[model samples]
Target: AQRVTQPEKLLSVFKGAPVELKCNYSYSGSPELFWYVQYSRQRLQLLLRHISRESIKGFTADLNKGETSFHLKKPFAQEEDSAMYYCALSRSPGGSYIPTFGRGTSLIVHP
Candidate 1:
């Protein structure tokens, strides 16, 4: 069975601190890993993808096949980036990446 695990339900910290959102998954075949973020009152947008090897808004994620994890990391967290984050995965076909979102980790940035 394919499953996505996000250990933290909520993460809060002051601005300019480093942040790491952990994610682990279980899949038999090749999986497409993605990180989707949603700010307050904003639509969810793709933050990064393992396949793309791209980082957005100071966030980057890497897929570890051995550990079966795709954790998101950022050197510094900004107040503007504080939002709800979800780690997602898709099947090999890549036609319909119906993401199974984790419970979500709400990041609160205090001034």
Candidate 2:
């Protein structure tokens, strides 16, 4: 069975501190991994994708195939970055790709 694990349900950090949200997954074949964030009243938006190799709002995540993990990181945390973050996995259940998200981790950045 394919599964995504997020050990922490909530992470708190002070402004200007570095932060890292851990995510692990088990799956066969190539899987699409993404970090989605919902800020306050805003809709859930894509934060980063393993394939994109791009950083958003100072956040970056690297997909480590050997470790089977995609961990999101930021050099510094901001109060505005506080939000609910979810680690998602996309795999083909048949011909169509299906997205499965972890329970989610709420980040609280204090000034």
Candidate 3:
């Protein structure tokens, strides 16, 4: 079974401070990892994918296969960056898509 885990339920940071959200997963097959974010009263949106190697809204995450982790990071925090973040894993070796998601981490940025 594939499982995704986010250790922190809530994270608080001051403006201009750095932020890191932890994520880990357990799977037997090759996994596709992604970070999703939802702003206040907004729908969940895809922040970035490990395969893309891209940064979104100043946040970036690299998949550490050795550690079975994908931690999101931002050099500087902003009030606007406050949101709920979720880590997801999905990959169907046999072509059936089954996605597992973490509980989510609520990020609060204080000005």
Top-scoring candidate (lDDT)? 3
Give the alpha carbon lDDT tens digit for every residue of 10-89 in model 2.
99999999999999999987889999999999999999989889989999999999999999999999999999999999
Worst 10 residues of 2 by lDDT: 91-100
Alpha-carbon local distance difference test for all models: 0.89, 0.93, 0.95
Off by over 4 Å in 2: 92-95
Off by over 4 Å in 1: 94-97
The TM-score of candidate 2 is: 0.94
**Ten contiguous residues with the weakest lDDT in model 3:** 91-100
Find the 10 residues in a row with the least total lDDT in model 1. 94-103
Q: lDDT by residue for model 3 over 59-108, one digit each (tens)?
A: 99999989999999999999999899999999846846788899999999
What TM-score does model 3 achieve against the real structure?
0.96
Better of 1 and 2 by TM-score: 2
